[model samples]
Target: MPTIIFVQQDGSEQRVHADVGQSVMQVAVNNQVPGILGDCGGSCSCATCHGYVEKDWAAHMPAAESYENDMLTCAMDVTDASRLTCQIIVTPELDGLVVRLPALQT
Candidate 1:
């Protein structure tokens, strides 16, 4: 299991252990972490799972896919670190990942 740290826009942090091979959004939804709706159920169609990868860890993750990049365009208050949580798969190498949720997600 890898621990993923979720930082809310207000600066609160919730750390959860995510099972390998699951999406970061899955771990958040399953644990009921606030601010991540994941409305499309991990599909790239919705930007509800929008979040920002922490600056320090941003380079460690894989690059965002084209579809995910397009979807992120609709995210609220998007930033350079903006990413769809559903597109972030948890793996052993991704331990200690930090993602910041947006203020509001549809």
Candidate 2:
């Protein structure tokens, strides 16, 4: 399992142990973490799981898929760091990954 750190807009944080092969959105929803609704259930059909990968960790993740980029237009507070949590798969190398919750979601 990998540990994922979710940081809220207020600077509060929650650390979750995620199962490998699961999406970050699934981990957040399973743990009842706020700021990640995962309304589309990790199917990549919604932008409700929007989050920002800390700049230092961004390069550790794969580039976002084009469809994900399309959905991001529905999200708020998007930036270069923005990512849909559903598109981010948990892996051993991603242990200690840090994701920042946006102030708002679509």
Candidate 1 overall Cα lDDT vs. reference? Answer: 0.91
Q: Please report, in order, the local distance difference test score of every candidate based on alpha carbons.
A: 0.91, 0.93
Can you give the TM-score per candidate against the true fold? 0.95, 0.96
Under the 3 Å rule for N, CA and C atoms, how many clashes does model 1 have?
A: 0
Q: Pick by TM-score: which candidate is best?
A: 2
The superposed Cα distance between candidate 2 and the true structure at residue 39, in angstroms, equals: 0.6
Q: Which candidate leads in lDDT?
A: 2
Q: Give the CA lDDT, 0 to 100, for residue 37 in model 2.
A: 96
By TM-score, how accurate is candidate 1? 0.95
Can you tell me which runs of candidate 2 are displaced by over 4 Å?
A: none
lDDT of 2 by residue, 1-106 (tens): 7999999989999999999999999999999989899998988888999999989988888999999999999999899999999999998989999999998777
